[model samples]
Target: MSTPTSDVHATSPAAEYLAFTLGQEEYGIDIQKVSEIRSYETPTRIANAPEFVKGVVNLRGIIVPIVDMRIKFKLGTPSYDQFTVVIILNIGHRVVGMVVDRVSDVTTLLPEQIKPAPEIGSAMNTDHIVGLGTLDERMLILVDIDKLMSSAEMGLIDAVAA
Candidate 1:
């Protein structure tokens, strides 16, 4: 299990997120869904896979697919650095990797700190977002990894980029 750092802040039920950054924004997913976080390492290419799919990496004994969340989210490519990380997440019994800029903390938030994704005129797609959590000085984008890892969408991304 990953240890929580002193900068981590938790409030209540929603406070169970593992927060990370991609570019300038901060995002979070439920900690229960995460298996591990490792340094951003190059993965072996899988033929016929999507461009956004960074191919596969061996985790323990299992081969897992890795996704560059920057490309998936329409953000430009992120430069790999010492701080870059591949966060392993288990969604619907399948393990996958998400490349992020850097991990920040394990944070907690109260129910009131979270709000439903706005439906109208939003610049970003809200489909994968469960809600937005607010801290006194910052906010975290709460993601529904299952939705983000939807097989149909994965197939589409793969088919198009292959």
Candidate 2:
């Protein structure tokens, strides 16, 4: 005699995500957009650039623009420490970088695990929020880095010429 099986596999397709944190919230992005992860480095400051645009870093021979997600999201004050990391992403023909508090890990989440973000009246923008992902007891705010980084508000359209 065998006990009834409760273990069942999710029917939804699985995709890997790069999980990161900003303040008290956790976020995830499609791993395919990520090219590399580098330690924090003070980039060359660009004059007249927005606050969220930290500056630009010469990655190899390529000049990459770095954006601070915390500042972009208006998440109060942002502090950079040893744990800070920069995720290099390749969107279309443009390569950009984003600064986050710290990267947790690469997680594989099934489609069923992701839920559409609820619309709520808040000062924070949710346009870039892909959805909310539920994994065990943790919830991740999945971000559409492509859309967010390439948006006109980011002023990356001009920078893409680089």
Candidate 3:
């Protein structure tokens, strides 16, 4: 006979995240959400769109909206350079692109390696933050890309579809 606690432990599997940098902080998103990575390019400006929502770019036949994570998180002034890249993500049925400083590498984290995000009150929204991943001396702010992209305030997914 097996214990319930042991069964729960057995079911918890390791998850892989695509690590990237936004300003000085390192962020990680679920690997499955990543569609592809492309070098930064100037996107056609959309009038009335939020500043963080840089604009849209034609990806093949699809028009993908690009969101600058730096601006969205209020990290600092964003700069475009050789290291800049767009991480195309497949969230829900919509495709979105996220601009990041640079991509680090894919990291696999076990359940034990992830720490719960602290409850810091309503001043900041932590709903999209999965947890903090610790590996060696590196710490990654794991983000729930799907939730962040689909949030009501973003108005991205629905607007793009329509």
- The most accurate candidate by lDDT is 3
In model 1, pairs of residues that clash are 10-108, 11-108, 15-108, 15-109
Q: Can you tell me which runs of candidate 2 are displaced by over 4 Å?
A: 1-12, 156-162
What residue runs in model 1 are displaced by over 4 Å at the alpha carbon?
Answer: 1-14, 120-124, 156-162
> What do the candidate models score in CA lDDT, each in turn?
0.82, 0.86, 0.89
lDDT of 2 by residue, 108-129 (tens): 9987788889997686678888
lDDT: the better of candidates 2 and 3: 3
TM-score of each predicted structure versus truth: 0.83, 0.88, 0.92
Model 1 Cα shift for residue 132 (angstroms): 0.9
- How would you encode candidate 1's per-residue C-alpha lDDT over 14-56 as one tens digit per residue? 4589999999999989998999999988998877677788888
Enumerate clash totals for all models, in the order shown: 4, 0, 0
Summed over model 3, clashes come to 0
**Model 3 CA lDDT for position 99:** 95
Model 3, residue pairs in steric clash: none
lDDT, candidate 3, equals 0.89
Error of 3 at 147 (Å): 1.0
Residue 129, candidate 3: Cα error in Å is: 0.4
